[model samples]
Target: MTDPETLAAATVVVPALVAALVWVLPRTWVTRTALVGALATGGLAAALTAVALTGDRPLAGPWLVIDVPGGLLVGIIGAVGLVSVLVSPAYLGAAAGALVDPRRRERTYYSALLVFWSALLAVPLAGTLGAAWLLVEATTAASALLVGFSGRATALEAGWKYLVLTSLGLGVALLGIVLLAAGTPEGGLGALSWQVLPTYAGGARSALVVYVLLLAGLAAKIGWAPVHNWLPDAHSEAPAPVSALLSAALLPAVLLVAWRCEQGLEPVIGVGPARDVLLVFGLLSVAVSVPFMLRPMAWKRLLAYSSLEHMGVVAIGLGFATPLALAGVAVHLVAHAVAKTLGFCLVTPLLAHAPEAARSPVSGIARSSPVLGGAMGLSLGSLAGLPPSPLFVSELLIVAGGFQAGRVVTATAAAVLLALAFSCLVRALLELTLGEAPARTGPVSGSASASGSVSGSVSGSASGSALPGLRGVGVLVAASLVLLLALAGAASWLPASDLVDTLMKGIA
Candidate 1:
């Protein structure tokens, strides 16, 4: 068998090479090439994850390390990227009518997606804070194109906003990195490696300042509140595949970088302040998202706010930083990735069957299309933390872990906030999947006027053919539901297991 490090490198390289190939390939071959590349990348990532998780020691080096956190995240990025690629051809087909130039769109979109996937795959494996920052900065450029791919006024505006805001945020992060480099006497890139930074800079007087700078900067990119103004618009406007990558892969990958900073700085800043910063951000994110989740909005927009809520949960788990909380973080990250990505993937079918859902909340979906409705319900239900969902299990562990960390007051506040968020989400889920669908303005099929016109029947058939890929969505949704259930069942014993013990050891 190949060594884990080679497998990890291949995961990043194969997609990148495919990206170049797609950029110049004939439009007819783009989808086939993309699918093959995505499969190869996902396979390599899975192999690396298996080694990192099941091996006796982490694979560490000056540039990359496959530790517990990195391994879990590598698996997530791979899974989400593969699913997004699988769904892309369908979404592009359904959206052909809206494109200015379909051929150019195919090449540009696939190339950008591959580039974005490659960058995200590298972030978790980065051994140095500097390397992670560079990888994250690379994502902003590629994803901006994807967010604005539709060429509509709103999409263009949303894409620009995403680019500007995230760029400014990264600027702040760069300043922090410069300060960190300045503080270390060795003063080389190696000094900023996770293993070296803490040893050299532990006693630096400016540690607190660096911590604030790093976390605050990363918050914007992570879509954490106060700085997350770009999230909803971007998610809503981007194509469904891109939205899945953003929510399930990009956001959590960036958060891992932030988590690494916290670990690297903890020795100097002490645990209390480090924990407090994360808690404040986590609480604010949960509190901020509930109102939006309650309001009637487009399906993708609602899921965007839900991202805020879930990211907050993970942050709180990090804030607690106990073994159980860390275990909860692991579970929450994977569960949220699967559930949220499924929710975004369903949007392609949702829009195909009802274009109105792009701008407004949908209803009577279960009544109209049972498969689409069931899939949406499962996705939303998992996100809402209903019974037997892994999110519920993970959130319970996080709150319990908070109390175990002796953060009783913080944990109590978080519990109350989580309950409120859950209620709001459930209300939204009901309104979305079960509420009365808007009354149709078109003539009923039995009406004499409708029965007399063959054009209407032809039109319906054409529209249905436009999204024939929807049948595949049902298969994906069924698989996601089964996977979520298995995770939930496994989560029960996670905190007491050896895996959790390994996670409790800091990422560095």
Candidate 2:
């Protein structure tokens, strides 16, 4: 097979095998094996991205294929997935440390995680809208289970809500897909394949209906407000690592599909109809997230609303369809993935020391856990669109791109709303990290923990391995910084950046 074919094949195959292997492995191997699988999957994506950079991607075909656009999504998904998985152990171990018998639960957790990971890996490889829809649905199934992995009442409710809402949305989207198929030659599915589908879709009488249904359905999954009820609940209730995947990876992947559909139909239905739908969804989403963000809530809940806002920004960027706006979409997608991953992962460590943080924000990380404080602060800052946060740069491009597209009024409104969000988010972060410090809390314990792990575990490992500190979360903090820097660099000066620009312009 050619290089793209090989990379594309491995993209799905390796994750499938790893998921199966990890499921049946003895307890000791579940976490470690899953981590390895995550890394391997990410490595393959990175290699594929490098190939895409060289402008030698495979043609979009009947099944798995590679091109600049697909390559970018694949690369971001894998990289973000790896980050989430690396931090999973810490979150899992913390949860385990609180359990009397964590082995069984750990097995179930990691197995579900691999399944979710596999589904996430399949999305960009899909060759047809039908196939992409199936992959997106598969993700909901696998991830709903992981969202409620703890099986707590809230987690269970979050999982149920996520499944029902997203499934209903997907059901609508499927109808649109069928209609899209009918719009083809003699209504055959062949014309509905990715390559030909778009050209055939927008000319039919049902084009507007198809576009609206598809947008509504995708909006629910993408966490756009008016249909975003599931987002905050699930993101807040799920384990931190899973939250990262849902927000950073899954949301964007689903959006990628919707983006393809939008661009596909733009030719026949007219760009105005499709673009307007995205703009409405985008505006409402940004507007809705701000009020929720301003309210004092749990850290993850706050971040969850932020996810909604960022998704809105992406929608706006895609709708504008200008070179700069599209580039902003690409930049923001990666920056948001990395920054949000860092933000959610920090919660795991925070919760380790202070479980009450689940319901309310913890104050004074800056004074006590300076490393944690600095990292959390950095994450919040980045998310708030501060300088040094590539999100800031991306947002600028998006607004400017909108203006350049002759969308001055809409761009102005979005900019005003985003500025409000930024200010409110900064205040929220200060409340989380700079206010009164929570009393140094005691740790819970029943299972094993690393040395100096936050729980009842001792400072030194039984095997004499070194540990970070009372929290043992410093590693996560440090990793967040590194990722933040990497994200900034990639936005400003990566070798593949021109490739990203080309891909972005295609979407535009």
Candidate 3:
């Protein structure tokens, strides 16, 4: 088969088949088989990325396109999906007490997860604006079921809010898509295809209007402020693996479309207007997240804010739109995907060791659980943009790129905000990983006070419930660190290519 066809089948059809097969499998085997399938999918994505990097252009078909930028997102979603699947066994174990019918719920949960995985796969491969929007909405529906899978009252509420709010955003996005389609040369569904739309609408007056409407809807769906009310609640309430996917995959995948839209409209509105709009959205997202990020917070909610901050970083990079900046944006996307997955996965052990600590103030991780503490510390460092972390390099490049683009004020603002965000995250990480575990009274004891040892203290708590030590955790942490190393070198080390040039050429 042809390369484009091969990549499309692997990215889209294979996952759909696996998702269907999951329900019929024995519940005990579901997680194992899903991981295997997800790994294979990730491998395919990596191969596709390699091909795109070497080729002059993306492998495109009638309904799908696999370009360098799109391939990066595809690879990210696939890699994060595999990691989330790997982490799911532990997540399911942590939720065991709350699940009424272990076997049935396991089946239901795995089914939903695979379906969610399949929908994510479809997102980056979508060729047309309408097709991309539909796949994104599909993700919301599939993940909402997984988010509320625990059946807790708050879980249900979070799920409903996620469904309603994101759906509203998608509705708005659809209007923009229809308007964009109307303005294209042929003025049909085909006009909205990524490859064709840019050529025409990039210089159209109507395209400017479409771009504004689309960016607003995308900002909301992607967890930008003023419309981000559902993000923290949903991420906090959902299972850890699902939370990882939402942050690592869904947000980026949707933002990919928004970035492309901005590129297409730049010629029509001029680069300044489009970049200014994105810059405002990006900066506002960064600023609005600060107050929540500064205080003591739930683990998932904190990471949710981190997602918002990083997405803003990406927007700022795109607004800069130089080759160096675009390169940093590419590297940053991969780095954040791997690092954030590690951050979310570490919470599984925390839940198993100190279930109450999920929402409680952080304490005793260093003394109680060395592995969780180390993993979390590294994640915090990476997310905080500490030296040797890819994020530090990525953020630096974006700032430098902004200056080169003559956006001195924007560059200064970005650097300052990043430093502030870093301090807050590092402080929170220190509090969580160090210091004595808070002592709880009565039948429910604390991790530090119970047995003077990590395992025993965790086991002693009634809610802690004796769960097996987390598996494959060390591997996830090790992989994330290695990914950071690769990201740090990616901007300079990548072979001579027109990837960044291609991405920027159409923008203005």
Indicate which candidate wins on TM-score: 1
| Count: clashes, candidate 1 | 0
TM-score of 2: 0.90
Judging by TM-score, tell me the better candidate of 1 and 3: 1
Q: Encode model 3's per-residue lDDT on 1-508: one tens digit a residue.
A: 6866677667676666677777798766777777777777778777776776666766666577777777778788888888888777766654532333645777677767878888887887787878888888888888998777777778889889998999998888888988877677866677877767666643556677788889888877798777888888888878888899999899999889898788766767788988988888888888878878999887778898899899888888988887778877887898889889888887766655666656655776665666666778888788888888888888888888899899999989988888889888888888877867765321222332111123224225323223232457778888888878877877565323477776665422
Enumerate clash totals for all models, in the order shown: 0, 1, 0
| Candidate 3, residue 362: lDDT | 71
Which stretches of model 2 miss by more than 4 angstroms?
96-103, 201-205, 441-476, 486-497, 504-508
Please give the lDDT score at residue 351 for candidate 3.
58
Q: Please provide the root mean square deviation of candidate 3 (C-alpha atoms, Å).
A: 4.1
Pairs of residues at least 3 apart in sequence or in different chains that clash in candidate 3: none
In order of appearance, the predictions have TM-scores of: 0.94, 0.90, 0.91
lDDT of 2: 0.77
How high is the CA lDDT of each candidate model? 0.84, 0.77, 0.76
> Worst ten-residue run, lDDT, model 2?
460-469
> Which of the predicted structures, 1 or 2, would earn the higher lDDT when compared with the native?
1
Look at candidate 3 and tell me the lDDT of residue 400: 85
Residue by residue across 121-240, what tens digits does model 1's lDDT show?
999999899999999999999999888888777888889999999999999988888888888767687878887667646354588788888888899899999898999999988888
Give the number of the best model, judged by lDDT: 1
Positional deviation of residue 202's Cα in model 3 after best superposition, in angstroms:
11
